[model samples]
Target: MEYGEAQQEDESTTKAAYNPTEEDIIEYARFLGILEEEDAKLLFIAREGIAAPLPPEWKPCQDEDGEIFYFNFSTGESSWDHPSDSYFRTRLVR
Candidate 1:
């Protein structure tokens, strides 16, 4: 198996499931600096369908619709929404 596939299999076996709390989502919003504290709550709710506590191998990606999103490694979910314009700005910087 390729290194990436091997690593994924190892992680799938070893990692515990994660469910992100409102507070956790808010904290991530603050870290991204995309929304104000008050707005973070709404963002959390709106994105809850796609949200998971960020996993160790979380990475940013763009969807087919051209919307930026996050991929959670642990849960194998691709529901994380783009938090803010700042997130895209930061990614561009990188």
Candidate 2:
């Protein structure tokens, strides 16, 4: 196929359930100043599958004390950190 046709095909593709590709994630990471922050590595880890993604049922929240926490609605469990160490290594730098 020609380059123009390939580009058209890509543009015409529907993304009902869009998940960013590694290139997309890296571009975002770069825009976010990846080299200047530790938390930026988390994006790479998550996108590259080096770490597991957070469980869909688990939600992240902050307490009144301004600390991070994870709540698992499926199990009625809550914790100061993610249940999976491999999912998120540290608090998000937001």
lDDT of candidates 1 onward, in order: 0.45, 0.49
Q: List the residue pairs that clash in candidate 1.
A: none
lDDT of 1 by residue, 1-94 (tens): 1123222223232225446666666666555553654553446433442243334665555545554455555666554453343433343221
Clashes of each: 0, 0
For model 2, residues 9-58, the per-residue Cα lDDT tens digits are 12113233357776766654554345425565457544543234456776
Candidate 1 residue 36 C-alpha distance from true site, Å: 3.6
Backbone clash pairs in model 2 (N, Cα, C under 3 Å; residues 3+ apart or in different chains), count: 0
| Candidate 2: residue pairs that collide | none
| Top-lDDT candidate index | 2
Candidate 1, run of 10 with poorest lDDT:
1-10
Q: Supply candidate 2's per-residue lDDT for 5.
A: 19
Q: Which residue runs of candidate 1 sit more than 4 Å off their true CA positions?
A: 1-10, 13-16, 37-94
